[model samples]
Target: DAGITQSPRYKITETGRQVTLMCHQTWSHSYMFWYRQDLGHGLRLIYYSAAADITDKGEVPDGYVVSRSKTENFPLTLESATRSQTSVYFCASSDWGSRNEQFFGPGTRLTVL
Candidate 1:
């Protein structure tokens, strides 16, 4: 497998602007998730998908994503990015046998200006 990956290792955007972080994996995991890392909040779940068109919103972030149709790509879009959204975002995937064990991407560092 090609393993998990996150694009745009770093990004800078102004408030009210839009930003999209891309994630991909070759392992074809059934479960995928997006999370943001911050000091007080730690790793906060933004969104997740159990399969291709099946998705659910997490505790934070207004993001749009889909799997299966794209094969392995999961893109998260911030319709209007804000300074409060600045953080390191990560993507993870887990297989059927090990739902609790996940493989994470390198992470994308986004800075909202």
Candidate 2:
């Protein structure tokens, strides 16, 4: 079974283009999260969903959006890509009440020119 997976492991786009990153997990976890990893910021949370339709904004959400209509899938979209938004994004999931341990997918590296 695929524990967690991310699509388009790497992406390069123009400054004004839009980019969507996909994430999927076989485990039916109640919580899912999207995080971006950068040099100084480490891993900053971009968005999170407690359940299928309950989503919330995280530390960095200005240029990104996320939705989870199904328990196993959570996708993040950058409305208008920018060079500052270029970073390695990671998707993670955890069961309810188990916030300490999360399963993370192979990250997606996005570079905006």
Best by lDDT: 2
As a whole number from 0 to 100, the lDDT of residue 74 in candidate 2 is 98
Per-residue lDDT tens digits of candidate 1, residues 32-65? 8999999989999989888887788898856444
Full-model lDDT, candidate 1: 0.85
lDDT digits (tens) for residues 4-93 of candidate 2:
999989999999998999999999999999999999889999999999999999999999989899999999999999999999999999
Question: Clashing residue pairs in candidate 2, if any?
Answer: none
lDDT of each: 0.85, 0.94
Clash pairs, candidate 1, are none
Model 1 lDDT at residue 12:
93
Q: In each prediction, how many residue pairs overlap at the backbone (N, C-alpha, C within less than 3 A)?
A: 0, 0
In terms of TM-score, which candidate is strongest? Answer: 2
Deviation from native of the Cα of residue 53 in model 1, angstroms: 1.0
* Model 1: ten consecutive residues of lowest lDDT: 62-71
